[model samples]
Target: MSSENKIEPGDVVKLSGAPNLHMTVDHISGNDVTCIWFDGSLHTISHKFSLSALVLVKKKGH
Candidate 1:
């Protein structure tokens, strides 16, 4: 994972950079981020990013 990549909560990540396909990261890890789908499914993505690439959208509301 490059230091340039910053992960945060509420970030709408582009899953494969495809139009409309995305996920929101609820938490961030050292080299991976934890994401949650509208269906409540959880996933962990690496900072490197790929077809499952993700980006920081916004911070989670307390």
Candidate 2:
């Protein structure tokens, strides 16, 4: 595999712009990525965002 970052299911990700809390990558279709995260009220929220709109989160000190 190439030494490049790639997003996959189960990976943690967030919005490229206006990032807040991180979301889990539930799935991907074409150019859309399905993300799931909990809201302030601890409610599960599922949303679809374009791949270009998401950034693969790299934890510090990997």
> Which candidate ranks first by TM-score, i.e. highest?
2
After superposition, the stretches of candidate 2 with alpha carbons farther than 4 Å from their true spots are 1-4, 59-62
- Model 1 Cα RMSD, Å? 6.2
CA lDDT of 6 in candidate 1? 54
Kindly report which residue pairs in candidate 1 clash with one another.
10-58, 11-56, 11-57, 11-58, 13-55
lDDT of 1 by residue, 1-62 (tens): 34335556666666545556566766655656666555335454433343235544443452
| Highest lDDT against the true fold, candidate | 2
**lDDT of all predictions:** 0.53, 0.83
Give the per-residue lDDT digits (tens) of candidate 2, residues 1-62: 13346778888888988578799888889899999999999999999999989888853235
Q: Compute each candidate's TM-score over C-alphas.
A: 0.46, 0.83
C-alpha RMSD of each candidate structure in angstroms: 6.2, 3.2
